[model samples]
Target: MTNDPLSPQSNDSQKRLMVALALSFAATAAYTFFFAPKPQPPGAEGADAGVVLAQGADAGTAEVAVPPPGNGGTAESTLTAEAPPPPLRKVDVARQEAKYTFSSEGAGLTFAELQGRKMREQQTLTIREGFDKLFGKPVPTAPQMNLAHPVPGQPLPLSISIEGNTPLPATTRYAVEEGTTPKGAGTLSFTGRQGPWEVTKSFLWPHEGFELVYTVTVRNTSAQPQSGELRVHYSRAIDPEFEHAPSFFGGVGNLSRSACWIDDKLHKLSPGDKPPEDTRGQVSFFGIDQQYFLSALYPLDGPMAGHCVLTATPTAREVAAGFPLNVGPGQTATFRFGGYLGPKDPDLLRTVPGVALRDAAGLSTAAAFHPKLEDTVDFGIWAVICKMLLAVMKFFHGLVGNWGVAIILLTVLVKLVLLPLTYRSMVSMEQVKKLQPRLEEIKKKFADDRERQNLETMKLYQEAKVNPLGGCLPMLIQMPVWIALFTSLRNSFDIYGEPFFGPVWTDLTYKDPTYILPLALGVSMIITQKMQPQMMDAQQAKMMTWVLPVIFTFTLLQYPAGLSLYIFTNNVLSIAQQYGLRKWLARKGGNPTGDGTAAVSAAGGKRK
Candidate 1:
């Protein structure tokens, strides 16, 4: 018998097998990485927050009758009970990074303007307009928590209510008192009394933080005990104009969500077609959110059992949380809650105490510092990888000082780490390509002997030191990094409204209005694919060469410019590496032909 071509003593064969096994592991990892479903746009399924409750009959059961405001009016004036509107008072609060406008109409925020942030066109990024201008008319205006009862028989439940024997008039105007907190923070007080019960709402805006503390105290001023529920209502229009708007990454409506943290996990509420139903649960935090910002209510002490109600009109959607209060004859019940109305920056959110929790039974012992708050950023299935990538990018950004430059540096760092494996993979694929002719010859020789054909094929591969899977393995190994980078850059709060490369590539978080980045990325992909050695049949290779670039180009058209920029930079680097590696192999006297013996002979020629 011919000496065994792949004897056990062959160290080269062992090394090749080890490389093959490593590459196989990478392929398996890539398969698992991509197996997750593509992320759906937030709120894509419907405008209604997912939890639907029966409102009409249920809400009526909990409704209480009270007199309208102004001079003595009876609770029985239901037919003509139009209480006079409360006088409007505006309170402006400013911190270093943002300014907020609050209206006393419902003791709710009216608008917030981020201090130095500007859109691509240099317009202010103001959250003032409740809804986008639709049709020919301007957007309708309303208070966030209007203290009005829903039309009788209406399906949506009322978010604001005074729940016991003593009910505050719907038109009661609160006496305003403004002051400073102990920490030199601005404070606003709204106090009002109805019958024997007195209510006071206080807001403390920190001197330099993203959240505010709101406290409501109810006291029994009379001889008898009193009990009532004070519902702090919140509502906003799910403006379709914001949906898929070009100003933000992932588009406007794509990131809007209404959800609550129940039992330590997030339950996303669906926006429904009908009026909102009420859901009761042990809630830690509840609210509605946009891509970069959120407006949520968090209980400071711990989780509290409360009612979460969702209401909607043709043009708007509302969500609110109800907190119960009961006071004895002389006791006061003060319910303290925290309000988060700012950017969903991971660093900032982490600073919010208890947002992350520790759990020992899981793969990771580290608990999320702010519980489910960081989930506002919406990193998809590969969250661990995404977070790590973000940390790396931030490190590079600190060094470079420019977000765009930092991203490019991050791409280079990733490529350098993978260089050694990539080199081996490319060489293995090149060797495989050279053996295609010999493989075809063996097939012809063993036309009728299938088993012999298989054995001969294995022998040929062993002798040639080739790993059949090497051609695609390196690409597979890089997929998780690619996905992670995509997710991190797309959701990065730092990149929002940040400009790069002048007007052509203004905001990294927004799509390239000129469509240049995506187009360039598609071309670069084609060039990179062409540079790689082909291991597949001619037809399949041809199809991939043309099809992949087209598919990627269209898919990336709507993605954030920062993500496209990373991909394009990576492709260019890959092309450069492949070209350099090909030359290195040639200089080493590596075989360009199928025969391994020929390469050995060439290398030995100079020595002889």
Candidate 2:
């Protein structure tokens, strides 16, 4: 009889093919949904704004008046309403590490771009122009004093009213003054004044550092005493460009943190928490931080009496801190402040001077400081492991002078350290493979009884002195290290623009632009699996051989190149070790198979 093409058997085969195709598509969609880089929801991009907290009666003494709901008004709108834009004059300062641009209008910093950075497209760190702009209004360009409470019916402190009434100009055209400091460091000064008050803003740019010492001097020119709170603002809007990038993890978008060091501890406020009403004490530092950059304000001389107010919207985060200021008539009050606007490099942050300060009476004291400023790195629960990995990588880089080579070396070292466990696992797997024939016979003998088959399988494993789970234990043990390494490579700023080989692997902190590394990694994994001794049932082994490689390849496609490089190197090392171990065992004539005769002979030899 001739089989017909349209027979039920043919139809069944076609249906099976369609189902398989549908499953493949579903799996692809599932992978994309779980592992693909997802665009953040509106207002959710920069959520982990660093620790924001406040203490002290002065913290929330003056409440910012917000217009009632349905007014279509925001704090920015309410504050800037009817305010004229100040005529802005540009000021540029260039150093070896960074370039700074300032506008005379509010003496607000317009931009700070780091030099020698690989990804320079959006490297400018300053998100906004002025400190007062944090509050949604145009305050004087220079940092100035704000009244604790404005007089009833009077304009808010540091508002347009202050600029309109006081002889102090809302916008002063600061004369550019240059001088060489005693240390031969270059100094840039912008000096200006409003009615009866002379304000001079000076910056001491070192020949070799990212930290800039900024000093603001306010002189009471009038015959009466002037008392108010001095305020410095650090505000940044989330970078829209990095919102979709893989490096934009943790605190991307509206996830920013505003934190202050109070009473020797770091106080962080959540997004929904109200800004502390009164934060009073030795405030060592307060700033706004994003994923890769930090903009912080520090008191140069000592812990100043200060409090911070942190506010955020869907697109921006603003931190405003106030320091007590009292300038006697005809007396000048010069306050020194330090500003850090750069990458969140732990080493760089450590190099920042004035982390410790001297108090009055010449006693040295620890300031309100977070230890190491390392909190900015956000290494998560495995932070300790991550730091260790980074240290090792850095050490390797120092020796090899190439990040890609260093990563390979790091992988080798990790593998060597875990060699014993992996060796044992390989032996166990080989034993399981040797027992596969016997296991298949037992399965067939008890084909109708799954419980009896499992019992007999366990008894067989016991008799052979082989652990069925030994192979899995080593992998489980190494899981944390693998996870830590992945996190470290992904979040490391040092690797952001670091090149592995040449232009092709230009940025290890980002995904491979050419997809070569991930594909190679996937291929290496397949080879490693094939080389390893397998003990799975035929169907299980077949499924793993095909599915695992594809799944890993797609999953790793979105990971940073550095991570992919590590995995690829590790797989290669594992394959080499497995091959070497197998050859060594064969030469030794040890039974790699758990056959009953080999087991009996080994036991008898041991007894002899």
- List model 1 lDDT by residue over 121-225, tens digit each: 121121232112211224332223221122232212112346667765433455678987555677888776555556678877666665666777777655556
- What is the alpha-carbon lDDT for the whole of candidate 1? 0.63
Candidate 2 regions exceeding 4 Å error are: 1-88, 117-176, 191-198, 219-228, 245-282, 290-292, 312-314, 326-333, 354-371, 441-455, 590-608
Superposition error at 300 for model 2 (Å): 1.8
Report the Cα lDDT for residue 346, model 1.
77
Candidate with best TM-score: 1
Tens-digit lDDT string for candidate 2 (483-602): 897777656777666878753565576566456788998888888878877787878777677788888788777667788898888888888898999898777664544453477445
The per-prediction tally of clashing pairs is: 20, 37
Give me the displacement of residue 356 in model 1, in angstroms.
20
Q: In model 1, how many backbone clashes occur?
A: 20
The alpha-carbon lDDT assigned to residue 234 of candidate 1 equals: 59
Which residue runs of candidate 1 sit more than 4 Å off their true CA positions?
A: 1-86, 118-160, 164-172, 221-224, 245-253, 270-279, 310-317, 329-331, 353-372, 440-465, 591-608
C-alpha positional error of residue 36 in candidate 2 after TM-score superposition, expressed in Å: 85
